[model samples]
Target: MSQDPPRIVIAGAGHAGGSAAAFLRQYGWKGAIVLVGEEPNAPYQRPPLSKAWLKGEATAESLALRPARFYAQQTIELRLGTRVGALDRTARQVTLSDGAVLGYDRLILALGARPRALPLPGAELAGVKALRGIADADALQAALGPGRRLAVIGGGYIGLEVAASARALGAEAVVIEREARVLARVAGHTLSAFLAAQHWAHGVEILTDAQVAAIEGEAGAARAVLLADGRRIPCDAVLVGIGAVPNSELAEAAGLDCAGGIVVDLAARSSDPAIYAIGDCTHRPLPLYGRSGRLESVPNAIEQAKQAAADICGRPPPSPEVPWFWSDQFDLRLQMAGLAFAAHEVVVRGTPDAPGFAVFHLDAEHRVLAVEAVNAPADFMAGRLLVAKQARVPPATLRDTTQPLRGITI
Candidate 1:
């Protein structure tokens, strides 16, 4: 008698988990694949939730990473709208919230993160929202329109993007950031200033170094934001885009090593060899930076998915790519490559006042550490390569506009 095929059970069917299922089959996994998700809908693109999707530029169907038929065609079983209640590591089984249990030979955990709550008084008010999924986006969209006021309680990419979208919808927006400047944590000073100016030019008020004390609500809805300095800014709604908290509780319960997120190696393998973790839930190895951290981006999720698939299929590992991220706010397209943790020098490739520009961060030895490109695709591409190769280039060579960026890599 022939033996039954091994079963691979994937928890949390978000972008990372969905992609892992597809890649597993493509990379030669002759096993039973089961993808389980908490969301009722199929996997969809999330970056556009604050930009194109909010602006009514993209449809629900368009956001689908893969059509519903694709899963069936691939013989991949999708168990949507159900949670992975418990993991039995010893038995290699997972109990679902719907009272179903699945036994697996291998497991992949892609439990993504949730939007961090405001933690202010009235944060639970009806009109105070956080954009993390389709439901949140829909609620926010309904609250925005002409003559409405939106008080954003963060200066990060999601907050800024939503503020821009509100402005486009003819709503008044005020961004309240506790930091000294917008994008302070993720971007360089130059990029921060430029983005701040852009939002200001678009008529979105930006408050830097301003801390929010509490959210004041009228009846059951958020009506205004109270500042720490006793300033009250009235608004029709509030959006708290402070950050995200990784959903690693399940992994932790399963006895997986976790810190900030589920700790995983380059192959997305957790402490347990039979189980792996990926996406925002994993504190993954960043080989380019000689460090490990949780990266909450689509690119990072896809990259880790590929890593897990290759490892499971016993194929040659894929080359490590430089970490990259992008944001679309107002008329700006910001693409960044690598991390700028210990940079010692900053170089400007183009004039900031111009239509396009790039900021390059370099270490003491002038090695390309990171690049922030504003509507500069060529610079982003070249910078990504330089970061991956860890190439050291002179500051003057990078600043020279006459030389081609790709050719100056030497």
Candidate 2:
């Protein structure tokens, strides 16, 4: 008699979990695979939630990562609208919210993350929402229309994206940032200033160095936002987009190493060899950054999923990747590569007025560290290659728009 293959169970059916299931099949895994998710919908692309989906340009069905038939045909058991309640490492089993326990020889935790919520008063008021899942987008989209006003509570990518989308839908939008400038924690000052100017030109009001004291409401519905500076901005709705927190509670409860996120190695293996974790829920080492951190991008999730799949299949893992991210606001397309934190200097290529530019962040040794490209795809691609190679280039050469980035020979 032939022996049965090991059972593989994946928690959190998001991008990472879905990818792992597909890749496992691609890599010739004949074992029984089960994917568990809290949401009713199947796996879908999240990048569209704040952009095309919010603007009503894309349908919910269009956002699916794979068609429903794909999952059925692949023989991948999908447990939708089901949550993993607890994990018993000793028994190598996970108990679901329905009180059903599923045994697994190998387990993958792609739990992802949740949007950080504001603890201020009136936070639970109607018309106040955070954009993370499709349900949130649906509620926000229904609230947006002509003559409506939206007050965004953060100046980060999600906040700004929603603000732009609100304006595109003929709604008045305002952005509030506690810091002196927008994107203070992510992009450099140059990119931040350029984005602020663009949003202002598009009729989006941006308030910096501003703090939200409370979200005042009437009859359990959001009415206006009260600022710390004694100013009240009337709005019909509010969006809280400060950031997100990793969904590492399952790993932590299981007694696995977790610190803001589940700690993992390059192979995506957690403390236990029988388990692995990936996506935004993991704090793994980055070779290029020379440190450990959590990356919240689609590319990172896909890459980590592939690594974990390979390790589970006893195949060679792919090479490490340099971190990258992208954002779309109105007509602007921003692509970034590498970590620019602690850079010595920034070199600007192209003019910001032309609405096409790339900012190169270099260390004191002139080594390319990071690149922020706005409407400059060529520069972004070249910069990614250069940053991966740790190539050194003169600041003057980067500042010259006439010089082709490909010819820099980095």
Residue pairs that clash (backbone atoms under 3 angstroms), model 1: none
Candidate 2 lDDT over residue span 181-215, tens digit each:
99999999999999999999999999999999999
Instruction: Give the least accurate 10-residue stretch of model 2, judged by summed lDDT.
Output: 1-10
Q: How accurate locally, in lDDT, is each candidate?
A: 0.92, 0.93
TM-score of each candidate structure, all chains considered together: 0.98, 0.98
| Stretches of model 2 off by over 4 angstroms after superposition | 1-3
Which residue pairs show collisions in model 2? none
Clashes of each: 0, 0
Model 1: residue 3 alpha-carbon error in angstroms: 9.2
